[model samples]
Target: MPEQVKLRDGTDTWVLALEPSDRERLVAGFEELSDESRRQRFLAPVSRLSEAMLDHLIDDVDGVDHVALVLFAEGPPHVYDPVAIARIVRYPDLPDAADLAVTVKDDWHGRGVASALLPVVIRRRPEGVTRILTEVASDNPASLAMLRRLGPTKISNTTPGVWDIEVDLTAHDLPQPIPLAVVPPEELDGKRLHPVLDAPGRHALRTRDLICPWLN
Candidate 1:
């Protein structure tokens, strides 16, 4: 079943796991994001999601024992910054513990979209996730303040306009706890180390495919 959270506005925001059915809505929301909003929310430029790209993201979702939550706007998804979209992925590996990402539409900023979305993330922080990491452009004081309110742990300047920050998730101050579980690698075989024995044909295939393409 998909996870969901109800906003204070009496509307419901659904957090669907990364799946094929959810890709269209996700891509549409991402494409609708304005450039300025994209700059503020992301660390880089993000064009609209293509089917292939969506497939790759979904694949990543399955590879990790992590959950990706989509914030719904009255049953629809919303867009965040393009450059910083990876913030969601990095959330799972934070120095502290938390499994949450915050993203807001450009036109929706200062309108409580981020504020409304934060609690949902806090509630969803994994069991042992007592520390959260975030990066905000130094010029973007508003974002820094938002993250600080969650709890000020550490701040380091990455660039003139970017600051990396961390938030601690001690239960005394917060509600949820992150589960202590680590996903292990799927394989550890000699075939992986001794590639020639496992797949001698692969070497010929690579040489034929790449060597001829370069020659042509």
Candidate 2:
């Protein structure tokens, strides 16, 4: 069964592991991303996801070392709108870590979509994967901030406009697994807001420490 997560705005999103059958929805979701969103995600101009890419993303995925999770909004009769996607693919040479990537629909931005999806991806990570790595454009502050909340992170400027981030999942000190599914938004009341939701519009770049280490 798909897990249901409630967003801060009180809307519900169903989270499920992506399967071969979800190719069409996934393509549609990619098509809906705004141009800027596409650039931020793929780090290049992508007009659309090609057929070969779709086939590889769905059919070629092994679901063990390579896992993909997608979030969908409940829609009218027999339909679901894909709103966000997160994936962790084990590094070919790095045994203890995997590469992480996440993207949320433009309209759904700042609604805590990525925040809800991230933990689910982590919890479902393949066994023995203790670290997560990601590359984000230096201009994309929101993503950097979201990652910092996970744990002690190592950030470095690998290229002029790109940064490499490594997060040690085992070092995260969260007291418990975050609840991704539950009814009644009130049930989440009084609970601490996820870092993504707590400080909207803030960027890690604004805080010098996040990027300064590389300069020293």
Candidate 3:
């Protein structure tokens, strides 16, 4: 679920929400992102999301409930657009403090975007989310290094060159995090917004997609 939020970073941060209506654009951008050879080397394919799917997800996305942050960077005058960024998705079966999955644009790598977002995520760390988690391809040293800088994280091999890492947010005195807008508000002017929705089995379906056809 996406939410409209304002964040204070000793400065100010405004994050726009990704409502259901933005499904096609969001999914399209995600597809484009995944298509990047650079990103493909590290991650798996992301299945194109449909409007109906988005509706189901957002309808039940309560802030402290099942929420996902779609972060993007902004331009001057507070224009929110794609930010080289990260996101947190909360799963009911998983531990409380949701796990984080981040992707920094190749061009923005090492520019402090990940660092900036981490503290915010830690601050807005959900009430029950004490630990944040993410998976990095074994070969991705840069990501591993950044994760290390964040704090204490448990590492376990998921596959030959893939690993799952969990970061303890409580130990880190991080500031509140806000969702960054990937699309501008003025652009959303008259777009039809759908109720956030997804198939109950879509997650499982995604797993199949990852191993079988493999969206990555």
Candidate 4:
């Protein structure tokens, strides 16, 4: 099932777990990415996703060791068109952390698509996942900005124009308790729910027992 998410612009988008049947949409979305976007995401200047890579992505949706989610519009004609994807894959040798990656369609850049989708992925963090790590090209300021919104990040420039960032999920304040139901419009008032990206913000709500602190 798809869940409705509210963007900072007050528009609605649907977030769903990627499935094998979504191969066509996923491919189409990746094909639309620009050269720079592709490089920032895959760390390579590739024009197309290989068959093996596509298969690995679609087949790793167990929602445990591998968690992936895609954001898309629900309107007709483009309902299945993926606007962005966020995924976290655990390392067998490094049990306490996972590598994270997020990519938004070029047309949807700067629209908070990644901001909205990231919280969804973080809420679904699997057991034993203490930290999330990602590698970003130094030139990719947009990707870096998105990661900064989560919290204070530990960044290392191991190589020229490449940075590795690590974020400790438990470093933030504990979330305030809220009902695990659809948030009503009245509750959406400024005082009712705090912005998820605000440092030290405590407002949060639950869905299916998963607490999403940054949904608002």
Candidate 5:
């Protein structure tokens, strides 16, 4: 079942795991992309979705290895229009990482559709997969912001206008709060501590020079 949600513009929508039967929606989605949009998205001249490409996108999906979350236009469940799709497919050699790809119908640009759908797919990615890899065109601020918003990123490849980066998803796994260190007593054995611990400013540090403030 698709999960009900709303875009940043308050437009109602739903998302589901992409299915092989959703081939028509995939075709329509790709068909709607302008040439520039296609280039920005696929990083090459992708005028059409080749049969092999379609097969891979359609058939190679599994919730674990090739996770995809497909967003639909506002409509009933049975009748649907797929407005966007985000996929995270694990690398065969790098099991801990996956290549991230996201596409939105050209008409839906600037509506916060990808912003809403991207993190969900990343969060839904398998446990062992702690890194996400992708390329974003320098001019495509939308896609760049989408990836950066999810986790800490590092540029792993130097492409002229296109950025090949890796996202450290584990950074999102914040550590459990542990008790802070016990504050050091000002006096050790009834004398000021060495350096008085971390003194405030220059004056404080100067006053803290002695291990213990013993009279000369």
Candidate 6:
């Protein structure tokens, strides 16, 4: 069943598990983000998501190591369009932790699209994952503030322009975590989001950082 939500602005939306068939919708959603939004989300001036990048994003969302939710708004009558997606990719070596990121279409900004997704995402996170990890660009204070609201968080500057954040998922007011169907990575297969490998003291790798897979 799809989860329905009413935004703070009195708009109705539905939240559902993102599936492989939603590739076109996912692509469309990325096209809707502003340059600054892409910068804050991917930590780079990503003008386009190449085919390889899209494959990395959609191919491994197994509801375990990679769990994701898409939020959609009603269009004409029964039609629904994706407005945002929130996802976590579990660390291959560190099963109890997952890297997190949320992307909302630029038009839906300040409308509580994310607020509606976070709790459901939390309640349904992969088993043994008690922590959520992410790196927010230092310049994006909005994301920084949102990270603070998740739970007890440990945050620090891993690089000159990025803030590494880890939020205690168990500390949040959500139901206990459950064991999800595990999907073993054939190898250590995740995109490195931050350009720097020398992020001294960084807790987790950017698991979905294939923003520029070809360059890597």
> Number of clashes in every candidate structure?
20, 0, 26, 1, 0, 0
lDDT of 6: 0.65
**What is candidate 3's lDDT per residue for 1-216, written digit by digit as tens?**
333443343323334333445444544444544354233333555455555545543444455544334455444566555543344555556546454545554444555655665555555555677665555666666666666666655565544555556666556453332221332344334321211112264343222111111111
lDDT by residue (63-108, candidate 6, tens digit) is 8788878777765677777777778777776777777777777777
In candidate 4, the residue pairs with backbone N, CA or C atoms under 3 Å apart (3 or more residues apart, or in different chains) clash, namely 196-214
Which consecutive 10 residues in model 3 have the weakest lDDT in total?
207-216
Q: Assess the local accuracy of residue 151 in candidate 1 as a C-alpha lDDT between 0 and 100.
A: 60
Task: Give lDDT tens digits, candidate 1, residues 166-196.
Answer: 6665636642322112212232111222112
Per-residue lDDT over 1-216 for candidate 4, one digit per residue giving the tens place of the 0 to 100 score: 677797788667888877667665565656566777766665556666556566566655588888777777543544455577777776555677676777776777787888888888888767798876656777877666666666555566554666666667776763332321333544323331112212241111000101111111
Q: Report the poorest 10 consecutive residues by lDDT, candidate 6.
A: 207-216
In terms of lDDT, the best-performing candidate is: 6
Off by over 4 Å in 5: 75-80, 173-216
Residue 206 in model 6: shift from native, Å? 4.5
Full-model lDDT for every candidate? 0.44, 0.64, 0.46, 0.61, 0.61, 0.65
Question: lDDT per residue, candidate 2, 73-159, as tens digits?
Answer: 654654667777777776656667776777776777888888888888888887799876666777887787777767766666545
- lDDT tens digits, residue span 1-216, model 5: 568778987778777887777666566656556788777766666666666666567676768787778787664545556677777777656678777777777677789888788767877886699887655666776676677666765542244566555677878453332211221332112322122112353221111100110001
Better of 1 and 6 by TM-score: 6
Point out the higher-scoring one by lDDT: 1 or 4: 4
TM-score of 6: 0.77
Query: TM-score of the candidate numbered 4?
Result: 0.74
* Model 4 poorest 10 in a row by lDDT: 203-212
Whichever of 2 and 6 has more lDDT, that candidate is 6
- Higher-lDDT candidate of 3 and 4: 4
What is every candidate's alpha-carbon RMSD to the true fold?
14.5, 13.2, 13.5, 13.4, 20.9, 10.1
